[model samples]
Target: MAEIVALFLALCVQLLALPVYVLSFLGLWDPFCKKVFFPFFMEKTMVNYNQKMLRHKQDLFRNMMDFADPSGKLSVLELGTGTGTNFQFFPPNCRITCTDPNPHFKERLAKSMAKNKHLEYGNFITTPGEDLSQIPDASVDVVVCTLVLCSVKNVEAVLREICRVLKPGGAFYFLEHVAAERSSWSFFWQQVYRPTWALVFDGCSLTRAIWADIEKASFSEIKLKHIHAPFPWTPIQAHIVGYAVK
Candidate 1:
């Protein structure tokens, strides 16, 4: 219905936007990433839209927390911490290690990170999901992925890595915008829009069945709760927030 139409229109916008982005990037007309990617998405993306969704995503992660080490001793590792939006929510007793692939935003990430200096120890590592083998197994109590898995280079490896790092009962909490429920019109728009969308955003695929893949990664205690973003429905952009216990 309306969602299908919007998806198709969004596809058209992406198709036309590709060349414009290339020409602009080449002409030294660099558009600040904040315009389309970072800041813009923080407001426009499904997970970040309603103020309630923000808290809800946090609550989902907090549920996994076991503060055995007191306020300053517990550690949480967050993936794709772009502009590091989730940093402020951590308890003063907790330290957070965050990672992202976009080195271009180091300064901005650092600036945002400064606020958390009072916390015992916090680190922002420049890395991607594939390289997470370095994090020790059973080390992190909570792994938070907020609107992040869509763009990762290797989804399968990342999930395995998350499982490896998580303590036996640790949780994998996420807020993701996933592939639309199947429909002719919705499917058509997603196919058409995918190429352009992938180019502008990080190789994010609109068609990936993220939930199924997460379960396929061999997580035994999987919990899925489907809900919509409190806005216009776009098939591939609907918000789903839930956690999987390891």
Candidate 2:
């Protein structure tokens, strides 16, 4: 069965990561897995999904860019900016500050920056989303996060940091996979595979009700919708995409 195959693949991935687990005590596991192993894994498995969603992602970025002031260059702070995948979608002349907990992504991030020459690089901050202490309060015009909340240690804390860093009336744009409807078949599978999925994918929870936390985060205005993304990975097909005003 397909489920059996999926589980088998997950187990295989865990086995491959066994050496990294052993290196956890030496503080090398997280960096190595995130910067090297995970990117390689995603590139192999997510090509089709990313291709399918390309148009949708483009439209979402266009909409988010509408919030930018036409007369001035935009300032953007991106959380969990893995490989700077969203850089191509940003409007020209925008200054982008990228933040990720794993510092080892610098090499890949630099490569992406080189490719997206339209956008200006503000610098990379090696800090988690929950604690953005290096960025001054109300410093950025827009904050962006994509496929990131599921792995964060505390979503609420990250949301608070987002609100604090954005200027008044600034926007928070996000695209995230979340829990499916409670009674759906996808939800059932999500629950069944969650433990293995989290272990293999660096603690990304397949069943997080992230929209609920966003609602409680008290954004001035929120425009969000749920849709099933065309993901080969069934448990994470349910997704949400939208922007909020701070």
TM-scores for candidates 1 onward, in order: 0.78, 0.86
* Whole-model lDDT values for every prediction: 0.69, 0.84
Clash-forming residue pairs, model 1? 71-93, 72-93
What's the distance in Å from true for residue 91, model 1?
2.7
Question: Residues 1-246, candidate 2, lDDT per residue (tens digit)?
Answer: 656765776667657767655677578866777878887775455446567778777877786555566667789999998778788789886899999887776877788899999999988998999999999998888999999999999999999999999988899999999999887778767866776567657789998999999999959999898988987657888999988999
What's the true lDDT of residue 120 in model 1?
49
Error of 2 at 104 (Å): 1.6
Candidate 1 lDDT for residue 43? 35
Clashing pairs in 2: none
Q: In every candidate, how many clashes are there? A: 2, 0
For residues 20-43, what per-residue lDDT tens digits would candidate 1 score against the true structure?
Answer: 567556863235553445544553
